[model samples]
Target: MAHGDITHIDIPVSDMARATAFYSGLFGWNIAEMPGFEGYPMWQAPNNISGGGLAPRDDGFEQPRSYVEVDSIDDTIVAAEAAGGSVARAKAPITETSAWAVIVDPDGNHIGLFEGVVGG
Candidate 1:
């Protein structure tokens, strides 16, 4: 994804099986667990252009979190802070060429930021 694109959306769930069945049944999404990402099942929309993971619910992740593609995590973090948002999570490595982080908006919404091919 290019800058400003919502790369992925993570929907927090309490019961994996129930949530998976509900979403897959209602949305006709292809939900399945990947090899490396077992407990968290991934769902792909029928269009194949939209997809995200059903994450296990946890503190600060009780609601759906959308990850946006950014040009640089460092710059975004700084910009977010300057814009009244605060860093919820510092930049973390996803792979050799990719990274991700989270920021809390003024309204307390936690949005994710990703850079590179992690969401591709």
Candidate 2:
């Protein structure tokens, strides 16, 4: 992941099974639910590009958003705030090696920030 690279994406779906079937069928994606993240199934595209999560359509997360990889989640959130963006979600650990955060741009579009696996 690079500083400005679009590293991941997340799509909200009303029906997990239905949405999973549709996307996997249409794009030949391989989606599976991880043990800890049971309800939020992650997907990988055929070309091996990693992006997105099929999240339930609740809690004002009914839209699709892309994540940009950053070297520092805290620094990026600060910069986003300085640039008139607001934090949607604070930086949180996804795993021992990774973390992510969400922010809303000046125009009100949601953007996700990902700090990829650290010190792996």
Candidate 3:
């Protein structure tokens, strides 16, 4: 994925099955539970390029958020802080080769930053 491009999205839901059914029927998305992430089902858009996950609404993530691909999560975090944004979640590994971080912008919008590619 290119830097600054929306690489993924996380949609907070109260009921995973219900939300999955609705989204799949409405948009024909391919939603399925990943092997390592059983409870959190991931979805691929009809176009097959864009994808996201359906996570339960929780304390830190109570709303939907999009993830932007970046060259380096640490660098992006620094830049975001310099631009008046605050880190919501420090960099955390998503997989052996991939990681993510959450940041709240100056306008209070939550955004995710993704770095590296799984198995890339």
Candidate 4:
């Protein structure tokens, strides 16, 4: 499995409009509302690669989290645990091809692990 770069991050917001405005002003980001996301809007930053999505949160969606792509979800989980982290969501497929899982690091910060659909 070959690890990919961090493609995007998702920021959960209580109010999408307010969050979007704040980020835009704070970072000078050109945030735009995207299709296929319903009411959620995404920001396209200058750097391009580290851009993030902003979505309205509902019940059961607690904590704003970030995702990091890895070569293998299992390997990443093992390393995180060895370094004092714990898995929040065991490695599982989000779709038939793509998989993702969540973990809490030593400091109790949430992170995500993703395995792409097409590649090994």
Query: Please, what are the lDDT tens digits per residue for candidate 2 over residues 1-120?
Result: 678999878999999999999999998989998777889999999888775689888786878989888999999999889999999989999888899999999999989888977435
For residues 1-71, what per-residue lDDT tens digits would candidate 4 score against the true structure? 23656656778889877898899999877788755456768787877656767867866347767777787
Ranking by lDDT: 3, 1, 2, 4
lDDT of model 2 at residue 15? 94
Residue 20 Cα positional deviation in candidate 2, in Å, after optimal superposition? 1.1
Clashing pairs in 4: none
Per-residue C-alpha lDDT of model 3 across residues 1-120, encoded as one tens digit per residue = 799999999999999889999999999999998778889999999899999999999888888999999999999999999999999999999899999999999999999999999655
Which tens-of-lDDT digit does each residue in 8-83 have in candidate 1? 9999999999999999999999999987677989999999989999999998789899999999999999999999
* Model 4 accuracy (lDDT, Cα): 0.77
Compared with the true structure, all predictions reach lDDT values of 0.92, 0.88, 0.93, 0.77
Candidate 3 Cα outliers beyond 4 Å, as residue runs: none
Query: How many Å off is the CA of 116 in candidate 1?
Result: 0.9
Best by TM-score: 3
Q: Distance from true position, residue 74, model 1, in Å?
A: 0.8
Residue 4's lDDT within candidate 2 is 92
